[model samples]
Target: MIKLIGILIVVIGFILKIDTLFTVLLAGVATGIVAGLDFNQIFTILGDSFVSNRGVSLFILTLPVIGVLERYGLKQRAVSLIEKLKRLTTGKVLTIYMIARQIAGALSIRMSGHPQFVRPLVNPMAQAAGLSNSDELKESDEEAIKALSAASENYGNFYGQNLFAGSSGVLLIASTLTQFGYNVTGLNIVKASTIMAVIALVVATIQFTLYDKKLNKSHKK
Candidate 1:
């Protein structure tokens, strides 16, 4: 039970607004010591874990490039492009991106949205479209717009990935069903996933539309 201090450490670190990476590393070292691991053993385990999941860090490489592009006004370009389409409301922008993301997922094309696209491109575009008026936004409205921008990426990624026949989620489902003596194929899972994806898209579209209405309502009051 004392070994569970790692979780406690994370909670305290976050509450105190510590550097996230340093806090996690400290927590890890503390947990290792409590578990009777020598310093060398703890370092070795950390190294092994890092190596095993290094693929996740690959995105970090894109950060410098993204930063450079943003420094050159990439986000401004995106905002300008979206603003040109007079009919493109904030909700419409999100809906369109969600649709594109879903289609890309169906084709097994990876779109690393949050940092590469959403933060640098989509969020700014949404903010521009969301402004839609000369009036400033209430803090809640601003937060909602940001949340919706992120949610659009999440919705598309989660529901869209399942549509691919070769996606890990589809394969896992087929394999798990086969283990339970139920014959299933990735293609079959994907077929069903397509319907679910459509349903999810519909739901997201409705939410986006309503959010737009809410924004308009807020501004009117």
Candidate 2:
């Protein structure tokens, strides 16, 4: 279909690095026009999306604060603290942090255990624990590894958070659904989240265990 082709064009154009964001926006507008929407309606849709996801803009402020905190020694503190614990393995430390991250999220605390924390802190600590040489990791590989670590934190947090009685996001969703004549309850959502979080924890633990075994074998070689 023409619409599907248009969607693929947007995806391929971005992948090809062909001025993607601007091009996609323009192409999307053109698609809307073809779908019988006027230019004014298209603009209104864009405006609505931007306004609805305004929380995204908070990233601009949050990033700078995270950067400043790192500059002031957050990374150093995390690594040094981990280093002092001689009994800890890299995988163990990450696994423990994963637990802590999930617990914090469940309590509705949006703690970002990401690049600022994990890369400069957790990954290096992990490498030190694993006795890994930085040179052994290709830049892309390192980035990928760090990205995985970051992603795990997000998963842990998202799934863990809302285990509490009053997570704002959970409440907001429940309230909105109720208003729309859906009988969703906060406790119901929280209970489902707890089940999902347990499943994810089991799965993630298995993955890390396998990865640790591979790293151990590599270290022996």
Candidate 3:
């Protein structure tokens, strides 16, 4: 069908590495034209869609605030706090944070997050632990430490959120299964999520141990 021309345009535009927003807009215009819509109609549709989904841009508001905080030595304070705890290695600190993050998520506390928590606090603390343990870390090692900190937050949130009694994910799962005539319940979903959370915690602990060993080995060389 000629209407499918938009799909082809999308594939071609992506293959050409065109700007994503431009590609999508162009494809939408082409599709609208092929479907017999005029320029005003297409523009109106795009405007309406943008207005409907404007909440997605709410994060933009936090950028300047985060920048101001970073300029005020937010990272330095986090590192200083971690430095006082002499026994906490990078891996141990991240592992402990991961556990706390998971527990918080399960309780629906929603306290830990990437932009609000990780960048401003968790990352600096983790980096400080690494610096405290070693004379100096290579740039690559420092980057890896930051990546691990972010990953720990993500892992904990993903596996633990489902354990919340009335989490959206659990409701969605129950609703979808019920639609297919399956008798899945919210309680069962919570139980399964708890089991998964426990498994993830075990795996995370082992991973942290291995990561610490690797860091120690690198420092020895």
User: Which is the leading candidate under TM-score?
Assistant: 1
- Global fold similarity of model 3 (TM-score): 0.71
The estimated TM-scores of all candidates read 0.74, 0.59, 0.71
What lDDT tens digits, residue by residue, belong to model 2 across residues 1-221?
56555687787788888996786787778777778889899999988988999988776777788778878987677667766776765567667767888888776676656744676676766655554422254465445456557756776777787787588868987899899999989998788888898898888777766766766666456
Clashing pairs in 1: none
Q: Local distance difference test, per candidate?
A: 0.89, 0.72, 0.86
- Give the runs in model 2 whose Cα sits over 4 Å from its true position: 1-65, 132-144, 172-183
Ranking of all predicted structures according to lDDT, beginning with the best and ending with the worst: 1, 3, 2
What is the lDDT, from 0 to 100, of the residue 50 in candidate 1? 90
Q: Give per-residue CA lDDT, model 3, range 2-77, as digits (tens).
A: 9988999899999999998999999999999999999999999999999999977776777788889999998998
Once fitted onto the true fold, the runs of candidate 3 whose alpha carbons sit more than 4 angstroms away are 1-59
Q: After superposition, how far is residue 78 of candidate 3 from its true place, in Å?
A: 0.4
Error of 3 at 37 (Å): 20
Model 2 pairs whose backbones collide: 105-161, 106-160, 106-161
TM for candidate 1 is 0.74
Q: Give candidate 2's whole-model lDDT.
A: 0.72
